[model samples]
Target: MSQPVYRYYAGASRTSRSRSAAWSALRWSGSLAVALYLSWLALFPYPSLSGAAADWLGGPIHRALGFAAYIIPLVLISALWRTFKEGRAAGGVIMAAASLASLISGAGVLAVSTHPFGVSPASWGGMLGSWLGEGLATALGGFGAFIACAAVFLLTLQVVLGLRLSVAAAWIAAVAADDFQKWRRSRQELATRMAGAPKGDDAVKDAAPAPAPAPEPVNVIAEKAPSGKGKRQPSRDGGPMPAASKRPGKYALPPLDLLKAPSGAGNTGKPQESEIKSAILALEQTFEDFKIEARVTGYAPGPVITRYEVTPAPGVKVSAFTALEKDIARALKAKGIRIIAPIPGKDAVGIEIPNARPALVVLREVLEGPALPPDAPLLSFAVGLSASGEPLSADLQKMPHLLVAGATNSGKSVFIHSLILSILYRARPDEVKFLLIDPKRLELTFYEGIPHLFDPIVPAEKVTVVTNPKEAASSLSNLVKIMESRYQRFQLYGVRNIDGYNKEADKR
Candidate 1:
């Protein structure tokens, strides 16, 4: 009967409870310390916490924190692997946490590499990049190594931000192309409206004299009024007639015969029908190979480029094709490809390929085409044809300025000559003036004896070019003075623009 001998284990119970409480408190304190330390690092990497904390923790500790931060990605990966093994939902949560950690670490690395923040490479982000360089530099070259590391870091940031580089690039290209086309259309429409409108001087010259109305009989009493008796009653209806307008006699415009007709203009001997069909078939096959559902709806052959319009199957992103532009071009045996994903307003995307046999754009062809109307502005001159094979002309009165530039043997001189010739065909010498600047005298010297010159062409001083520094400077100064005088005149007239001023003068 030993039932009365059983004793309570209270001492053991108290000791176990006390141990648990101490461990819990220690854990909480450790967490709080870590959080506060992180806050301090963020607020001031080199904290001045009354200078005591800084004295206690020296440079080695600071560097250690940086290195530890840089290795966060590795730690996160290990944690993610454990969580995934434990539970699926917990794995997803760990993935999200890891992504955030990677993003922050990657961003820090990028910042240090790009700009000299005076931070040591021992710091978190910088350390990662430095390690990457040590591994990649010998194999990939210094620049390539740096770029490879940058791309890795940037990829992490992009992933977290839910951005795909290919998608973004395609979208930007599409939008830019659409905006450009809209601008061109609006400009062409404006030119059409202006071309059809009558000029003030032209209207006056074209007006016909009105036939005289049947004369009304004057009263005999009024006609026979006594001399000096009463002042003759003035006619209420009729006023003084305007002064008879004088017309400029027949001055001949420059002949269009000066320009040569476009030769071999059409697609005469370019890629044959068989070749085109083969190319189209190849493109379709490539799409099929890539598992992209698309149909080549049609093809348009142009002077320098051939455009193929492709309609992607529903639910297929246009960016898919855009991303495969190089592959498609290679398949088609072409030099390059320009993919306009979802060519604005159309359901189809456009893939422009360079023509196998490109056609030359003849200035004469543009000048002779429908680009110029019978009553086009005096300044209107053809530059080239549009993609639709229509000539494109520009108005100098609208432009008010032009700058021609090209490398040697690039047809800059020929283009300028064509422009000047176009002007001569439309305007009289007095209507427009030219001030040729020939620092490289060879290009503009041929235009010397033309009547449109504002200043007489002077012989070159030394090298058959305006090589004298002082003379060139003086000529430029003179141009500035001329420009200032014109500005002053524009201001004096109370007109906002040259066009408005010209129209006002025409009314008078």
Candidate 2:
């Protein structure tokens, strides 16, 4: 009895698979037939066996599209391929826009190329082409219309094909820079060869064998100048040579490509209208229950938070909402809710609620995007994305001294990580240095021997990353002495600041 039941279940599974395979085959066959028929309609003038049906169907399309009708079959094949491979026929709004642009631009190209008054009335370009093309020709002349349509077509191709302009631009720049460097090297080599080569016939005469000169008398008290080391030289007091000075090599900042690109699908990642409406309704209901009269007027969507503007009715005290902040958060089911009473330069109060899935902010965007100032200092770093979704950059030089006070996992470490990456991507070790003191020790242990640390020549195990309280305090005290010393020098030099003092010293 058990074997019979097992056999029956196996037979049913096989039957289901067979049915699915048959359905898929049929769908593909139908799609192929339709594609081939459409291609024939677009390309050939001959009618099918169903002559009347073909004429009825293809005549209008041919008349409206003319030569541009070829686009229909091409688009259909591409969409069919995408559906077969990726389980989808279309993408987002940009894809739709690209398709429309292709159609219009194709028609415009055909219309402008064909003479308006010459040839048959129903020429290669149909009525739409004739209408669109002749108008553009009349407005901007034939050549201008052709250029405009061609540009639109090219731009549409880029969008539809998902080509990256940045990658192409970078490739071009790299080729040009490499070529320029090679050219400079060739010129320098030629110059050096010319400089060393014999000058006139005198060099040929000097090349002849010559007799050795008589030795000059030596001064017993004179010191011999040092030459290349066949053996290590001793110091002036006959001790072993002091350790050689360690001059740093040219330092290049890490490339921006090392950082990951943003993972957004080119959307703001804002809450849906339905969600916002529901939130507004819940908030209003909560206020009503508390005997307060207020209604949500507007909302600003952001990556991490959505701020809703609330307007209280006349005679309603603002304190009423503040007193029930916790209750309102509970009703909205939102944590870390913030309220701005009578928001500055605004008539309504603002309530900020955290988003469900907060968008991850990447450091690369802050470094490259317009969020940071164009003339920002070398020490400037990205803070984070603001509530309104704008990236914020702050200058450590301007802050001079800043305190990081927050609970564990409140993004203090995350902020520091961004700061380190920002500096690594912007400045070299010689231009700026870090005196990192991680009391936790674990947060900064990985950056132990990095050349950007203050007193980098010292052994990494000794003082690179100060973790002990006593050591950090000692370092700070030493820094104070250095700062006072600089201040005295500035006063003596009659300069107000470091920049001023440096400029004055440069003149000397």
Candidate 3:
């Protein structure tokens, strides 16, 4: 029973294979028929002798003569050529060369046939030879014309068919692209669903949670055993451990003297905001004692501090002020304090204080602020919170250009977004434009519909997508042309940059 089943399955497989082959052959036949029909329309002027003769032969005679005589031999020759060249696949090249040669030969024959010239022999031998030569030439010329006309007809047919094919192919490609996009969206949705599903313990373990805190150590001490009669173990918690007898490789905490004083001065035995204020005032007094003028910049909840922007009196060396950083830190009763003496490009010093309650400055507020003048030279950037926890804004006109570097998740994107939002709020669409190139496809896609956008959100033409170094070089060549044209315009107008040109235009 199994043998019979196996045989039946094998037979079915064979049958299916044969059917597939037959279908492929049918499709090819149809395509060939179409190609030939088109070729015939273009090359109809060229006649086939065999086809002509058969048509002229009497109806009964033609039926007896059969069309197979002309068709069968040509079909056999084509099949044989295809089979022989199947491995190398040079048939297309051969066909193209043959077509070209036929066209040239046809043109030559047409020219010769249209020319009016007759040759007369002077002697008997010459006349006989001339007659034979003339007959041969006429035959060759007729054959050439026939081939040329056929080639032209076929070529014209190919061009028409190719155009139709191209249009059809474009439509198919568009449909396929749409389908692919839909598939991609579906896949993303599926992935998101899977990610949202409850995970197992293994998945939790893979996430690797934060390490557990270490246990605290106890101090122990030992004393010399009674004259070394026998060594005795000391109690674990008796007295202060000798420095040498302490646990190996353990670090000793720093002395309490290094700790900073609480922001307030004169313990009122009751914590009050006045005490915190007094503490800051006391800190400022200390700065005065050092002969350094300091101002209180920020104060908050605990670890209260103040910022001082100071300038040493004239004739005081900046280095002399910086040298007091360690002494200032010690005097302030603070563990850590930074001093920026004679800040870069300025004669003022910057001292920062940690605040008790740092104020939060939302980015939205800055973006909603008043716009800068059209002629304003400065570009502003939001640097993070100062020591006092106040949001800081730096004028870019002073820096000109900034180079920002940070590790991942360092708020780089947020900073950039803030800058863009600020600019958008301050400048009109005509006054500013952005050239955004985000290959990842997400960053600037939101701004695609904005009128200020120059090129399409995504390049529409393949030629514009520079895929190679050579293409980039070609692009640079075009850019050079644009630059040269701009320069010429500048020269003609006797202006400098875009600003000068715009100013002159306004005057005109």
Question: Pick by lDDT: which candidate is best?
Answer: 2
The CA-based lDDT of model 3 is what?
0.47
TM-score against native, each model? 0.45, 0.47, 0.33
Q: Which residue pairs clash within candidate 1?
A: none
Query: lDDT per residue, candidate 2, 1-508, as tens digits?
Result: 7999999999999999999999999998998899888777766645754356458767777788788888877766766675677765557576778866776777777777776443234546677777767777778777877788778977776566555667767999999999999999999999999899888888867865564563332111112225411122333333222112123334433445566666665445678789899999999999989889889999988887899999999988777878888998999898868889878998898899988767777876566554443245666788877777777788886895787779988889888889887776555565667878888888887788787787323443355888878878877787778789989999999998776876787799
Evaluated against the true structure, the overall lDDT of model 2 is: 0.72
Better TM-score candidate (1, 3): 1
Better of 1 and 3 by lDDT: 1
Query: How many backbone collisions does model 3 have?
Result: 8
| TM-score (C-alpha, index-matched) for candidate 2 | 0.47
lDDT of 1 by residue, 340-409 (tens): 8888899999988887877777765665555654456766777775544456888877775577778989
Residue-level lDDT of model 3, residues 297-413, one tens digit each, is 543332234555655566656676577776666655556666776557866776654444433444532321222222233245445444443335666657755776699988677
The regions of model 2 sitting more than 4 angstroms off are 1-250, 266-269, 456-463, 468-473, 503-508
- Displacement of the residue 126 alpha carbon in candidate 1, Å: 30
TM-score order, best first, reads 2, 1, 3
